[model samples]
Target: MSIKSATPYFLLNGRTEQAIALYQRALGAKTESLQRFGDVDGSCPTAMRNRVMHAMLRVGNAVLMMSDGPEDVKLPEGGNVSVALDFETPAALRQSVEALAATGKVLERVFEAPWGALFGVVQDEFGIQWMVTSPLK
Candidate 1:
């Protein structure tokens, strides 16, 4: 069997909506589809029924998937994973960094890297880390 595509899936605890909103504002992401737990068969708990079961967000050319996972599950503290975004221009990269910094923590201000590209890192309010970079000219 051959693998087709790999997508980043986020289990946002109970903050799926908030994460989606942040992505939309920072990355110009568009919601392709969203499904509430209540939309599924009656197996979901009452409290979770109104929560997002699944969502598809289109950010640039990538599709980011997300959901409000099971109520009993808790995300680990300081996870090692991060979402990397590469931009075609340095101006675009800086704009995205500024947008995310409005509501997120900028770990690194945009600067030219030793590899000859502009790079920065930000951790959003939802605790998702993003590594933003611009292609070398």
Candidate 2:
């Protein structure tokens, strides 16, 4: 298969581990690999070394990556963009939303929209926005 330039890469703060876990619970994420900052065998500072330097979780067809922020760097406020999920079934859609709501804020409930698809929006506990939907045939 050929690659495309359309995929997104999110830059999260110091909660890489927690974010990964949340996605796992809500999206059936399977962590492909996680390299801690301490795992960086280079000459990086001790404080910076043990932090998450790089980690990847494969959530279905998407790959989400994360890492720690600089020592004192704070996460930014709400911005553009949200994760989009296409569910395979209505049951999956409902279950996923309920699970996500456990640790996140539900902006909207999953329901049939005027656009002819069931959709909803949420913000995970880690402050990441998500939009789940399933198209009707």
The top-ranked prediction according to lDDT is: 1
Runs in model 1 deviating more than 4 A are: none
lDDT of 1 by residue, 57-113 (tens): 999999999988877888762278888999989878878888888887899888889
Candidate 1 displacement at residue 115 in angstroms? 1.8
lDDT of 2 by residue, 44-71 (tens): 7777777787887887788777777665
Per-prediction TM-score, please? 0.90, 0.85
lDDT of 2: 0.77
Residue 78 shift from truth in candidate 1, angstroms: 5.8
Please, what is the whole-model Cα lDDT of each candidate in the order they appear? 0.86, 0.77
Task: Please identify model 2 stretches exceeding 4 Å from their true place.
Answer: 1-5
TM-score for model 1?
0.90
What is the model-wide C-alpha lDDT for candidate 1?
A: 0.86
Strongest candidate by TM-score: 1
